[model samples]
Target: MSELIHESVLDIFCKYATLRREEMTLETSLLAAGMDSLDAVEILFALEERFDITIPNPASVTEATVGDVVNLVSKLVAEKEASPSA
Candidate 1:
């Protein structure tokens, strides 16, 4: 699942970002790299379709990094999996 999330992130990033995969850093600014608001929304939408989870804050989209996003996704998926379905 984490691999899938990471791939999905890179896929979306390739669609709009000029930065190479190697250029991405934990502090690399997605905005500075040209991830506009609409692009971010598109990324969120793609993530939703690719993964079966929902991120509450499209705005608070973490600035950690691609790796950070992967970690965040992993954490969220695990949390959701751990919770009992009411």
Candidate 2:
């Protein structure tokens, strides 16, 4: 599951930020990868769509690293999966 989430998040970074896969690591900061505020928002939108979840506060995601986003999305995915009403 983490692998899938990682792959998807990497793809989003690649598409929106124009970052190369070789330039990323778990601890790599998105901002350092040339992502600005707008890029973060765009990636958040992509993530929400990809994961089928809603992010109420996109601003908070701007400072996250690749692993952070992966972990966050993974958590959200887990919660949604565990919840019958989600």
Candidate 3:
């Protein structure tokens, strides 16, 4: 599940980043990869829609590495799966 989340998040990032998917790594910084503030918001929204989960904080996205976003999405996915409402 985490791997799937990682791939999906990477795919979303690729849509907004100037760098190619092959050039990105878990430690790659989103901003350093050519993502601006608007890209951050768009990525967050994409993640939310793809995973059907809410990101409680938006600030984290701007300064995050690829791994950070992957981990966050994984956690949110797990929470949603565990929730009774879900």
Candidate 4:
């Protein structure tokens, strides 16, 4: 799960933020990297699409770094995987 989340986050940053995976770390701040509100929303949408999980509220996301997003996405994926209907 950790690896998948890590890869997914790398993909998100690479695609949306136009960042290289080598330039990112768990503590790398998205805002510090120049991620704006629209970038955040786009990343969220991309995450949902890639992981096939609903994030519920976009405005409610308080993640400050790539690690935070990774954690959230991992949790959501776990929950979805654990559900019988998923």
Candidate 5:
């Protein structure tokens, strides 16, 4: 599940980043590694739009690893599943 989320994020970034998937470590800091803030925001917005969920904050995701993003998304998905809207 985490891998799927990681792939989704990387796929978006790959379109905007010069870096390839192999070049990114799971723990690599995309922010520190030269990912433009605007692109990051775009990716964040894309994730929420694609996933049909709200992401708390982009800043909170700054320190995230690929796995962390996956975990957060997975947790949110699980929560949504646990409490569906009527």
Candidate 6:
């Protein structure tokens, strides 16, 4: 599930990134990959819709790496799955 989330997150980032998908790595900085504040918000919105989870802190996404976002999404997904309403 985490691997699927990672791939999906990477795909989402690739949609807004100036860099090619092959050039992106987990360590790559989001800002350096041509993402701005607006892109970050869009990415967050996309993630929320894709995973059916809410991001409590939108600001952190702007400075995070691909791996960071994957981790966050994984955590959120797990939380959602664990919740009674899910």
Residue 5 displacement in candidate 5 (angstroms): 1.6
Query: Please, what is the TM-score per model?
Result: 0.73, 0.90, 0.94, 0.85, 0.78, 0.94
Off by over 4 Å in 2: 58-60
lDDT of each: 0.70, 0.86, 0.90, 0.79, 0.71, 0.90
Worst 10 residues of 4 by lDDT: 56-65
Identify the runs in model 4 with alpha carbons over 4 angstroms from their true place.
58-63
Clashes of each: 0, 0, 0, 0, 0, 0
Candidate 6 stretches with Cα past 4 Å from truth are none
Better of 1 and 4 by TM-score: 4
Over 1-86, each residue of candidate 2 has an lDDT whose tens digit, in order, gives 99999999999999766568988898988887778888888888999999998766755565789999999899999999999896
Better of 5 and 6 by lDDT: 6
Q: For candidate 5, give the lDDT of residue 61.
A: 55
Q: What CA RMSD would you report for each candidate?
A: 2.7, 1.5, 0.9, 1.9, 2.1, 1.0
lDDT of 5 by residue, 4-59 (tens): 77788778767766667788777766565457667678877888886777888656
Is candidate 3 or 6 superior in TM-score?
A: 3
C-alpha lDDT (0 to 100) for residue 36 of candidate 2: 82
Residue 24 local lDDT, model 3: 93
> Candidate 1, which ten residues in sequence have the lowest lDDT sum?
58-67
Model 4 agreement with the true structure over 9-86: per-residue lDDT tens digits: 788777666556788888877776667778888888888999999887754443478888888889999999999998
Please give, for residues 1-86, the per-residue lDDT of candidate 1 as tens digits. 77776777787777877787767664666675667767777777776676777867754553445666677678878887888981
Residue 83, candidate 2: how far off, in angstroms?
Answer: 0.6
The residue-level lDDT of candidate 1 at 47 comes to 68
**Top TM-score: which candidate number?**
3
Candidate 3: where is the Cα deviation over 4 Å? none
